[model samples]
Target: MHVLITGAAGFLGQRLVHALAACRELDGQPLSRLTLVDQVEAPAPEIAGVECVARAVDIAAPGALDASLDEHPQVIFHLAAVVSSAAEADLDLGTTVNFEATRALLEGCRARKLSSTRLIMASSVAVYGGDLPDVVEDMTALTPQSSYGTQKAMCELLITDYSRRGLVDGRVLRLPTIVIRPGRPNAAASSFASSILREPLNGEDAVCPVPTDLELFVMSPRRVTEALIHGAEVAGEAFGPSRALMLPGITVSVAEMLEALRETGGEAALARVRHEPDPRIEAIVASWPARFINARARELGFQGDANLRDIVESYLGERD
Candidate 1:
C-alpha cells in the first residue's frame, strides 16, 4: 500500500512517518511507497522494503500537489495547517494554506475516483466554540471563533460532503490540543501547552501565557499518532451519519499540568515556569471547548493517555 503524508516535516507528521516505518504495513498490506511533502524538505526515514520520497514543495502552489498525488496513494494523511495563532495573525496566508491547499488536495483525490482511498485529515477542537455544553458531544455544533478553526471546520464539511457523494473515502479526526509535543515552539496558541513542559524540562525558562486554572483537552503525541493511524483503517459505514468525530482526550488545568511537571522534574523545574499572560493567546485558547464526551471515538476504539503524569513521563522517555 502506498501512503502519502503532507506536513511530513511537522512534529506530528514526522512522528507518524516514523511510526509507519516501524509498522512496515498498512491495512494488512505491505507498505510499498511513501511520498512526504512539505514547504521544507522532510527528513526521509529509511525503512526496509519502502520507497520513501521526500519532496520540499509548496503544496498550496498551483499544480504542486500533482507530484505528491501522482502515486495515487491508498492512504493519505493530511496533517498540514497554518495553526491557530499564526492563522489569526495572517488571514491571507491561513486561507491560502489551510483552505485552498486542503481543497486542492481533496480535488486531487476526487479526480482519481479511487473508492479504496482513505483520506484521513487532522482537524482541531478549535472547530467547537460559543455557548458550549459542559461537555462537547458528537452532535455538538461547530461554532469556530478563530480563523484557523473556521478553516478546519469548513474542511470538515467538505470532507463530509465529498465522502457522502463517494468522491473520496474521508475521515476527519477533530484532535484535541496535543501536549508535551517535542521540538521548539511554533505559532500555535496552544504551543504554550507543550512549551511550559518541554522548555522547563530541558532546563530552560518557559512562559505560561494563560491562567493557572485555564483548562485544556489534551492528548499525548504518541496517542495522537496512534489515533490517526486507527482512524485511517475504520470502515466508512461505522461512521454512521457523519464522517467526522472528536477524538477522546483528558481535561487538565494549567495548574494540574504544572503539578505533574513538578512531580516529574522537581521544584526547580516547576520554578522555571513563569506566568506572563498573553491576552491574544488566552482568548484564542479560552474560546476552545475543553471538555468533551467523545463516546463515539471511544466506541470506535480510540484511547487517551493514563494521566498528565504519564504524558509527561512519556515525553521524557521518547525524547531520551
Candidate 2:
C-alpha cells in the first residue's frame, strides 16, 4: 500500500510516521511507499520494506498537490492545519491552509477518480461550542465559536459530502486537545495544556493561563497516534453516513493536571508552574466542551488515556 501524510514535520505527524515505520504495514497490506508532505521538508524514515519520499510543498498553492495525487496513494493522512489560536489570529491564513487546501486536496482526489483511497483527516474538539451539553455527543450540532473550529467543521462537511457522492473515501477524527506535547509551546490556545506538564518536568518555569478549575478534554500523544492509525485501518463502511468520529478522551481540570505533575515530577516540578490568567486563552478554551460521550469512538475501537497521571508519566518516560 502507498500512503501519503501531510504535516509530516509537526509533532503529531512525526509521531505517526515513527509509529507507521515500526509497524511496517497498514490494514494488513505491506506499506511499500510513504510520501511525507509539509511546508518544510519532512525527514524520511528508513523502514525495511518501505520507500519514503519527503516533499516540501505549500499544499494551499494552486496545483501544489497535483503531482502527489497523480502518484495515487491508496491512503492519505491529512494532519496539516494552522491550529486554533494561530488560525483565529489570521483569518486568511487559517482559511487558506485549513479549509481551502483541504477542499483542493479533495477535489484533486475526485478529479483523479481515486474512489478507493482512504483520506483520514485530523479534526478537533473545538468543533463543539456555545451552549454545549454536559457531554458532547457524535450527533451534537456543530456550533463552532472559533475560526479554527469553523474551518474544521466546514472541511468535515465537505469530506462527508464527497464520501457520500462516491468521489472519495474519507474519515474525520475529531480530536480533543492533545496534552503533554514535547517541545516549546506554540500559538494554540491550549498550549498551556502541555506547557504546565512539559515545562515543569523539564525543570523550567511554566505559566498556567487559565483557572485551576477550568476543565479540558484531553488525549495523550500516545493515544492520539494510535487513534490515527486505527482510523486508517478501520473499514470505511464502519463510519456509516457521517464519516466523522469524535475520539475518546479524558476530562481533567487544570488543578488535576498540576496534581498529576506533582505526582510524576515531584513538588519541585509543581512549584515551577505559576498561575497567571490570560483572558484570550481562557475564552478560547472555555468555548470548547470539556466532556464528551464518545460512544461511537469506543464502538469503533478507539481508546483514550486512562487518566492524567498516566499521560504525564508517558511524557516523562519519553523525556528520560
Candidate 3:
C-alpha cells in the first residue's frame, strides 16, 4: 500500500501518521511507501519497512502536487484546509485552498487515470446549518452558512460526482468538532472548544466565547484518526449513491465540557475558565447542528467517545 496524507504537519495529520506507522498496513496490504505533504515539510516517521517522503508544497498552487501524484498512492487522505474563522475572515484564501485545491486534486487523480485510488477527505459538521432538525442525518440537505462550510460541501459534491464517473473512489467523512486538541490554538472558530479545557488544565486562564448552554457535536482526536483509516478500507459500493458519511459523535454543551474539565482537573482548573462572548465565533458555531442521528455511520461500525469525561481523560492520558 502506498499512502499519502496532506496537511501532514498539523496535529491531527501527525497523529494519523503515527497511527498508520503503528499499523504498518491498510486494506489488507502492507504499507510500503508513505508520502506526507503540507505547506511545511512534515517529519518523516521512520517506519521499519516503509519509505517515508515528506514534501513541503502549497497544494493550492498549480502543479504543486504533480510530483506526489506521479507516485500514484493507493490511498490519499486529504486533510488540508484553511479552517473556519480564518476562512470566514478571508474568502479568497478560503476558496483557493478549500475549494479550488480540492478540485485540482480530484482532477489530478482523473488525469492520471488512478481509478483504484481511494481519496478520503475530512469534511465537517459545519456543512449542516440553518433550520436544522434536532437530529441531523447523513442524507440531510447541505445548507452551509459559512464560507468554510460551503467550500467543504462543494468538495463533497465534487468527490461524489468523480466517484460516480469512475474517475476515483472517494470517501467524505463529515467530522464533528474535535475536542481537546493538543498544542496552542489555531484560527478555527472551534479552537475555543479545546482551549477552554486545555488551557485551564495547564493552569492558565481560558475564555468561553459562546454561551455555556451552547451545544456542539464533538469527537476525540483518537476516534477521528480511526475513522480516517477505516474510511479507506470500506468498500466503495458500501457508500451507494453518495460518497459522504456523517460520522457519529456525542452532543455536548459548553457547561458539560466545563464540568468534564472540572472532574478531571479539579476546582482550580474550573476556576481558571472565564466566560466572554464573541459574536463572530458564536454565529459560526451556532449555525452548526449540535445533534445528529448518524445511523448509517453507526451501522458501518464507526464509534465515538463514551462521554465528555472520557474525552477529557483521553487528552490528559496522552499528555501524561
Q: What TM-score fits each model?
A: 0.95, 0.97, 0.96
All models: lDDT? Answer: 0.90, 0.92, 0.92
Clashes of each: 0, 0, 0
Candidate 2 lDDT score relative to the true structure: 0.92
Q: Cα miss at 263, model 1 (Å)? A: 1.3
**Which has the higher lDDT value, candidate number 1 or candidate number 3?**
3
Candidate 3 regions exceeding 4 Å error are none
Tens-digit per-residue lDDT, 86-175, candidate 1: 888899999999999989888988887766689999999988888999888899999987798899999999988888888889999988
Off by over 4 Å in 2: none
Candidate 2 lDDT by residue in tens digits, 118-223: 9999998888888988888888999998898899999999999999999999999998889888889877778899999899888899999999999999999999
Q: Best-fitting candidate, measured by TM-score? A: 2
**Model 1 TM-score, all chains together:** 0.95
What does the lDDT come to for candidate 1?
Answer: 0.90
